[model samples]
Target: MVNGTNTSGFGYDSSTHSVIAEPAVWDSYIQVHKEAGKWRNKIFPHYEDLCIIFGKDRAQGNKAKDFAQMEEDANNEEQSEQIEGGFEEQTTENEDSPNIGSKKRKKVDDVIKGITIAANLL
Candidate 1:
């Protein structure tokens, strides 16, 4: 009872009386669905409404924390650069000064003593 050359299990194109492959049927279905409306056209308004209702506080808090952390990191980096520059200047000056070795040894001893005191306090 079937038409000519339509023995394939895929969709039958009645006009052409030929069997459409599964992939072709799916492609045509998707094409028709897309022509009806875009996927986002159905969901964008709901997404926007949800963001407006729920995103404000969480977004602002995260942004504030991130900005603060960035500023703190920048300040720490700047201070470290200044400290390194100061040490370089000190070494250059100390090269011309008398008792350069003694001066550096005394500074090292002072730092060690400060660390010892801090350890004792802890």
Candidate 2:
């Protein structure tokens, strides 16, 4: 919110002389201008160039999206690195594993006394 107003949504588009209601329309207008070879900024372009692209209401929505994507990408990269490091650390930690519960049961056989280790454990 800038100037106590959320400047992101439908706004007036004087470039085509109409109110741009959706982001898709604004993006198309920019693409059209770029294909026409006249996409540019004239010094203080806040009221001139950007107004044509986003209109009066959506001043920073596109920029905000770009920044958000950049932040997400950075986070993903960091997470990828962390996962790779985890694998490396896991291999070393497995050497001192606390898996004593999975150890094989000791062998015992005493048919006369009726004491025997179950075959299922083998």
Give per-model TM-scores. Answer: 0.26, 0.26
For model 2, the superposed segments whose C-alpha errors exceed 4 Å read: 1-65, 96-122
lDDT of 2 by residue, 1-122 (tens): 11236544545455654444455655666576665223322123264555457665653654555645765675677668657755665666577663421231111113312421332233
Candidate 1 local lDDT, 30-80, one digit each (tens): 576766323311323254345456664655654455645765675677668
Residue 24 accuracy (lDDT) in model 2: 63
Whole-structure CA lDDT of model 2: 0.47
The deviation in Å at residue 43 for candidate 1 is 24
- lDDT of candidate 2 at residue 2, scale 0 to 100: 16
TM-score for candidate 1, residues paired by index = 0.26
